[model samples]
Each structure stands twice: as structure tokens, then as C-alpha cells.
Target: MKLVRPLPAYLVQRYHGWKATTFAENKSWYRRLAEDGQHPRAMVISCCDSRVHVTSIFGADQGEFFIHRNIANLVPPYRPDGDYHGTSAAVEYAVTSLKVAHLVVLGHSGCGGVRGCFDMCSGHAPELEEETSFIGRWMELLRPGYERTAGCEGTEQRLRALEQQAVIISLENLLTFPFVRAAVEEESLTLHGLWNDIGSGGLEQYDPESDDFLPI
Candidate 1:
């Protein structure tokens, strides 16, 4: 608790500035959201990368999307091991309680987590190979994704492939949850996979029929 403290001066200044501007302009909308609670139509699972801004990309308003973020935007297959499951817990709440109509697995280029997974799997990151490495264990969830892109030509191509694969893997894992599967089967929920090129600002969506990512 010693490390926890009040907001820094710069952040406090920015917060007040936003409160005086963006917040002031939408006070009524904020008040309604606070009173009625959120009922977002979509749930987005995206990477923890700071550069990948989900709300900005969608031009979404506050409470428009229920979002969960983690390393590489990875989703593990449903496992009822009775341990701490942050991402799974969020997905459960979004699907069961929030009843979000859409579930989006979003990935992006130049993701440090995806690069870490590629390095670890390629025997380049020994630090991540340690059993106690939390990131390593988490990145293991995307190992199968790396395997799928093993035949890719260049390192960049392989890494990019893994990035897209992260989205595909998460989409596949979403179906492992019984509630998610049932919702999809009943046409109550839809799953989507998306990858972004950070530099170019280009978005690609996974097409199940074509089994490839296509420009959206």
C-alpha cells in the first residue's frame, strides 16, 4: 500500500481540464449512465498495448462498449480450475449479465506481448521461459497461434501473422465457454476477430468463410 498514492499533479491537471470540458459538455449523458447503469451492445477484448485505443478506433461514446484488456488480447480455453481468472470473469459478466450482442477480439501490429510470445517460442527470450514468469505463462496461451504461423517467411511476417492469430485464437476460445457457445448457436451473440495496422491505421477483419483476414 505504500506505493499507492494520490494522483500526480500533471494527471490531476488533465483530469480537471477534461472534467471542465468533455465531462461538462456531456453531464446529462453521464448522469443518465450513472443512474440507469451501462448496457453496452458489444464487448471488446483487446491487448494491453497503450497504442491500441479501442474507443478511439470505434469512435465510441462512454459506456457504448464493455471492454476487457490483457496481454496480446489472448483468451484461454474455458477451464474451471477455481483459481483467479480475471479475463474469464470479465467475459462471463459481459456475456451472462450484460448480454452484449457482439464479442470482438481485437489485436494489433507491433504488440510487445505478441512479440514476446514469438521470441519465447523461438527460444530468443529466456527470461520469459522461466516458470515464474507471469508474462511467459500468459503468452503460452498464444503458443498454438505461433505454431500456426510457423511457416511464415520473414520474422516480421511471422510476428504479424501471430498478431492476427491472436485475434483468431481468442475468437476460437470464446466458443469454449458453454454460455458463449449457446448464445452463438441461438444467434443471440456474434463473435468477431479484428487486427489493426498501427502505423497505417488500417483494419482487417477475420472472415470465417475465407479463413483469412480481409480489409474492413
Candidate 2:
């Protein structure tokens, strides 16, 4: 039952090339990070899309950001029922232990997970609606957002709205954590919502004051 496999030849060679070039050039920096331990200034929770590059987007170095990638960048509500919560665990560590100053929930355009959820909720993707489907269960978190966006006239508009809703919902759920709420209220931590347009190469930030995603 070996579910995992080794890297292919091409990827292995590419990794070694990167190690020689990038790692070799930053050997001292990497060593220092290992020795001192990581103290990232921000915690980024983004989608598992290969196109959404957080490091490149922020021009951040290795030890600058603690990132967590999950489907649709969705954050479930605070449920302390002794279940395995991977995203919650990361949020707990980043907020409580790492004391990251900023917690960013990054969503993006052309997200397959979002599209799948949209289809599932709309009765188009019956497979995802099954109880045995992990994606369907995980996507339940976005159902509220779907409700809001489902009224849109066009399919494209609905999907895009749902993408932004994912960011908004995640930001709301982040506050459900007591530590997260306390940190924000005391000014130790700030929460940010960002949506990236994959095709247009544009970044829009959610503004609580105006309740809109304004371009940055």
C-alpha cells in the first residue's frame, strides 16, 4: 500500500539544478534560518493552484512568510470536536506560537476547486455532491458564498463572485478562533483578504470599510 512514489528523473534533475544554483547562492541565508528558527512576519493561506505564486507576488524570502495552501483557500468554522483539522492547526501555530503579524487569505481566479464547488452546489457536478466526496464536504464551507453568488445572471460572473466570496468567508472564519480574535482586537495581528486574477495578472484586496475588492 505504498501510495507515494519517488520524483521522476526530470524533476529530480531540476531540483538538483535549483539546489546548486539557488540554494548554493543562498547557503548562508538558509543556514542562518535553520539555526535561528523561522519567525515569519505573515501567515498566508492560499489556494493550492500552481499558478498562484505567493512568494513571487510578495517578493518574500524564505523565512518571511509562513504559508498554507488548501483547496479554494477555504477556512472552516471553529469546530473543536477533536477532529483532524489541518488548516486550523496551521492557523493555531502561526497565530499563537509564531505570532505572525498578518494573516492573509488569498483566493484567485480560474480556481478549479471553486468551479467544482459552484458546479456541485448548482447540481451540475453530481460526483462532488456525494457524501463520500472529500471535496464536496470541504466545499460545504463555501456554500454560504454560493448562496449569495448564485443569483448572478451569468455563469462567469457567479464563479468570479464565488472566488471573492471564498476570501471573505475565510476572513470571517479566521475570527472564530479565540486567539485570532484577541490578537486582532489587541492590534497584534491583522487579517487580509486578497483575490488574484490569474489571467489578467491583477491583485485585488478586500476593503472592509467599503466592502469591495479594490485593486492594489
Give the total clashing residue pairs for model 1: 0
Segments in model 1 whose C-alpha atoms lie over 4 Å from true places? none
Give the Cα lDDT of each candidate.
0.95, 0.95
**lDDT, candidate 2, 60-105, per-residue tens:** 9899999999999999888999999999999999999999999999
lDDT of 1 by residue, 1-216 (tens): 898999989999999999999999999999999999999999999999999999999999999999999999999999989999999999999999999999999999999999999999999999999999999999999999999998999999999999999998888898999999999999999999999999999999999999899999
Superposition TM-score, candidate 1 onto the true structure: 0.98
Q: Which ranges of candidate 2 are over 4 A from the true structure?
A: 1-4
What's the TM-score of each model vs. the native? 0.98, 0.97
